[model samples]
Target: MTSDIALSVKDLKTYFYTNNRCNKAINGVSFDIRRGKTLCIVGESGCGKSVTASTIMQLLPTLSRIEAGSITYHAERGDIRIDQLARNGAEIRKIRGAEIAMIFQDPMTALNPVYTIGFQIEESLKYHTDLSLKEIKKKAIDLLRDMGIPMPEKRVDEYPHQFSGGMRQRAMIAMAMSCNPKILIADEPTTALDVTIQAQIFKLMDKLKAEHDTAIMLITHDMGVVAELADEVAVMYMGNIVEAGSVDDVLRSPKHPYTRALLDSIPVLGQGKKQAIKAIKGATPDPYERPNGCSFAPRCDFATKECDVMPDEEYISKSHRIMCANYKAVS
Candidate 1:
């Protein structure tokens, strides 16, 4: 791995087994998250974005297992393969909230309803640092203040239900940043917020990235968010990255059919009301019965007979790659 790369996930395959059936939640996904940069993983629901994040965090459930590949965290101490670590082991536990942190999609469910917001943030500090109780409390207040929550001193003692949707999300971010983690995984952090609040959240994230030099893996289905916040972007479909490149490359010169479909679906700001949105036809394939060839072949408008055989990844440039058999013709 390069020095700039904070984490490298290679050919990661995570599967869930239940009732004699296998659901491939993540299939051969690979990406490198560079320090102080944002890598946005954009795709529709059930495209395995959250599963990829969970796999990296070693937080998969009992029935789910990593069947192949590696997740290498490029730590200051050494390169650690996160996929090989025991789920609840000491080493991973230490790394989970300190070296790496996550802001889950929904704060209402993720946060403990009974505990004060400050208590939750302090819990991470207690495990990761040797700060005294008083110090921890002060730090928690400071974090809440940093998140733009008004009157942190009072709000710290409040429970999750006491805060609004945006404030709760900010509190989750505050808790996640308590330990100054190197890599931050935010799975649709702004999904539940209003437009104004969403803008504030993105601005705050940008500020945090600049201040902490944290590498961020942001998973979302919003291409608008990708265009705004992503330094690099990966278009995932059916558990695989169909295209990946710098934001400009992928957004401006998208090669894969799915990527184009996604871009076309986005409503442009100045486009008149009569401008028709092109929604991608067909739903994602069933994980238990994935197609033998290209997973997207069933939905692609440009799919050919050759699509019945899986296409090898074709490099458009050192920074851009696509997994389409007819990328040349399509481009």
Candidate 2:
């Protein structure tokens, strides 16, 4: 309900129910995203990063259900609350591309292989805005051009196959912002692109965030991206947020064992004096069957018998908190 907070997620637990088992993808995930800032959700693959992103936008798949959560959107129009799982695809449709847009990881899979780029972008514009087809086409082209897609006017008529990977990603960005969404959820957007293109895309996103005042929820495993674009970083492990803080505080001097392990794994240029790469020991636990206590206990070096209890999030500062059993002792 706060004006400054763009999105507030409380007790978010999204689950995927199969015939065999019910997988708790996001377990009690909670966070607040302030307006016009990037909140990077970082974690390993299958740690419920994408699910959490989709849950925020109320865009979960048909079979998967939001087990529990209250996602509130504080918008200029009004405060909208969504019981993410309970809301049907039709109700959630009102938010997607209209208020809360999502830019998926792969543009090729996300974008229509059949429809022209212009048509797809224009379709969203038509649905959200009262813009006519002709007007929407113009807007779509402008958006494409803005995203640095070459000859967007001509390229608008082409299908997905016509453009390069970077260009296609740009098109996806254009499509995401077609309706000028307030909240843009980008799920590992720079994954497959090369370094140059990745830089370009990152710059483009920063530029767009500045110009549009969009609140971005960037979900990725890349710590480099977190350092560059994140105003705040929420480190997830298993299915829960293990640490949340400003980029400066947590990234510079991570308090949690999981976080420290992650940062230590990042290969630096001239720091070979230290030991070899210290990656987290254990693999991410199966979402269907989490451990008895702290999700990261299996891998946490600081973990003790006390970690058998549900670890409490201890606040390091006003802006930083770590949910670990041994943060104080480690410090």
Candidate 3:
């Protein structure tokens, strides 16, 4: 663990056991999240983007278990192997909200409908900090204000149903930021909002990153969101990262066929209406019976017989790496 890196996940393998079948939701995934930087995990749904985040947070469901790998959190106090910690233990409980916080995709379900917004925001502060009730309430209001909510003093007393969709998302962000976490994992924070709200959320995230220097692990499928917010980008397929690099390098010069296919699927701003959008050819492989080789090979235009075996990671540059046997051909 280096001083700059906030967290490092190496060879992570999270699987779900159901009906005597092992579904490898996240297999051999690895990445580093640096302080004050945004790492976007982008791919189609079921690509294990959310699973990776959940694994780090130790919030996986009962049926799923971390089969292998290490999640190392570089704390100011010391380096801690999160994977080794007992899930729901006192140590992980302290670190979950205080050192690292998460903003979930659906605020409605994540938030307690019965509780007042202020109370919910204050919950973490009460548990994580030694702050007095008055101070906690004040901080809750301040966080809401920081999240661009109007009349925070009044809104704090309101319930989740009283707030609009965007407001609920902002409240979620406020709650996540209340503890001043070193790492903030936002799982599609703006997925349910309109474009305007999405832009506002992104702006709010940018402001928070600038002010707090928080390491953000953003899981999203939208390339536009990745383009707007990511400092580093990882393209995942079938629970594995097929390509990763600086956002500029990954987006502009993608090496893996899957990465290129994802990029090509994005609609261009001024392209003629007659121009057809490109879509990836095949569905993601069945989780219970994943391909023995490259997971994306079935859908990859550049795939060949050699792709029948999993390809080792190859570095295109000091910062860019791709896991594709046919990368050179595509390049």
Q: Which one wins on lDDT? A: 1
Error of 3 at 60 (Å): 0.7
The TM-score-based order of candidates, best leading, equals: 1, 3, 2
Give the lowest summed-lDDT range of ten residues in model 1: 279-288
Q: Once all C-alphas are superposed, what RMSD does model 1 give against the true structure?
A: 0.9
* lDDT value, candidate 2, whole model: 0.87
CA displacement after TM-score superposition, residue 205 of candidate 2 (Å): 0.6
Query: Which ranges of candidate 3 are over 4 A from the true structure?
Result: 274-276
Q: State the number of backbone clashes in model 3.
A: 0
lDDT against true structure, model 3:
0.93
lDDT of all predictions: 0.94, 0.87, 0.93
Candidate 1 residue-wise lDDT, 1-331, digit = tens:
4999999999999999999999988889899999999999999999999999999999899999999999999999999999888889999999999999999999999999999999999999999999999999999999999999999999999999999999999999999999999999999999988989999999999999999999999999899899999999999988899999999999999999999988888898988897889988888888889998899999889989999988888898989999999987786
List the candidates ranked by lDDT, beginning with the highest.
Answer: 1, 3, 2
Task: Write down the TM-score of every candidate.
Answer: 0.98, 0.95, 0.98
Give one digit per residue, the lDDT tens place, for model 2 in 177-235: 98888888999998979989999999999998899889999998989889999999999
| Model 2 TM-score, 2 decimals | 0.95
Candidate 3 has its poorest 10 consecutive residues by lDDT at 268-277
Per candidate, the number of residue pairs that clash is 0, 0, 0
Candidate 3 residue lDDT tens string, 111-154: 99999999999999999999999999999999999888999999
